[model samples]
Target: MNLNPEQITDYANTFIKVLIDYSPKLISAFIILFAGLYIIRLINRFIRRIMVKRNLDPTLTRFLADILLWVLRIILFVSFISKLGIETSSFVAILGAMGLAVGLSLQGSLSNFAGGMLIILFKPFRVSDTIEAQGVVGTVSEIQIFVTKLVTANNQTIFIPNGSLSNGNIINYSLEKIRRADLTIAISYDTNIKEAKDIITAVLKNNPKILETPAAEVSVKNLTDSAIQIAVRPWANNEDFWGVYADTLQNCKQAFDDAGIIIQPFFKESSKKNNPTEQLE
Candidate 1:
């Protein structure tokens, strides 16, 4: 099967001619590939700048930019392959099938991703907001594609899947600039309701954190066998809610003690009646 030198030269010439014919297409494809990558970077940077200017969420911004870049790169790759005389329709079909398989396999993750998108768009809560959701109460530390991170008051971290988070009941304590502190205090039945109310009202007024506009309320809420339950509600700035709440309780107790308003301990009468020896004393 050995060819003569003249035949070998002809074969070499044919190969060289084929290379010459395809040289421009190959060079153009390479140029397009590089140029497309550079353009993609530029587009990504431009999008990021716009997102920053618009004050979009950082997590969503980065995720969207990455998706856009990858999609663009995939299109560029398919185009490059097509330039080499490959059938891109079959390539696209293969990609579609692979995407469908991956989508089916990652259903939960995709749902979480969609949930994250909804959260980002609607903004039920934001980073640093104190929220109670899915039986976890904490400050939102991070909102990610699959989960939301929360830091509890005790400094414990919790990761909640976004899918359930989006669907669950969320109490965003930080949404309101002001919050009401509801405290219930019990006093002996013999204690004068008006006097006790006055003492508790004074406690609320003395606290600087409590708001003055709405006016604090202290009223008899209910009566049990041993004591009268008084409801004390005071408004305070959200940031000062806990401080106001703790301070009001302490101050009210002290004021009541000083004013001779007797606070009824639970089961005090029951214990006294149950113990006949103590009753004799």
Candidate 2:
């Protein structure tokens, strides 16, 4: 049909009005979509840079940052989708269901992760500290997410579950600045306590390994039928514990014998026959 000039102008204006109304919607959708994705990338990079600058642990910093960035990106994606008239509630429900399924599958790993977090935060022990936990005594080497690594006294590497460590008692020997090295020296009952004590004191003094501040202690701790048990307690730096322990034992024995302090062997019968009062003491 051939339209009049007025009819043609009216049709042209109507088409222009339609385009104008939809142009804003198209632009807004594009801006929300592309800009949201770009912002997510920029934010992820920013978080990584900040974490690195803070000197955060490589593992923890990276893990947390990645999680945060993913959450932000997901939010932006939902916003963008909503701008295009997509329903976010169904997407959120689907994501929640997937997350629940994944979480259930990773239940054991999540337990280890929780246990590791507890260890990191509470700090019951640290790397290189000699600790007794999970029925194992060893030097802690690392506190990884799934396991607690240790180097045994014999230099064997052991990986223990953090769950067991957290539940059990943790005996950390390295935490103490000074450790008491205890030794029980048995001398013949006939030997004078004074002579034995003097001999032990001289041996401790000659070594100079024991701390002078606390002074090496010598006391007659027990009087058995077969022997007089003298308790020798020496204080030494934790680092030199083994050296001081071995040398002090040898020195005490040699010095006592040279001083003519007669020695006696400890017997199970002797301790067993002791009076109830002495046993309790």
TM-score on alpha carbons, each prediction = 0.87, 0.68
lDDT tens digits, residue span 68-164, model 1: 9999999899989888778999988999999999999999999999999899889999999989899778899999989999998778899999999
lDDT of model 1 at position 81:
85
Please estimate how well model 1 matches the true structure, expressed as its whole-model Cα lDDT: 0.87
Off by over 4 Å in 1: 1-18, 265-281
The lDDT of model 2 is 0.80
Query: Predicted candidate 1: what Cα RMSD to the true structure?
Result: 7.5
lDDT of 1 at 86: 84
lDDT of 2 at 195: 74
The C-alpha lDDT values of all candidates are 0.87, 0.80
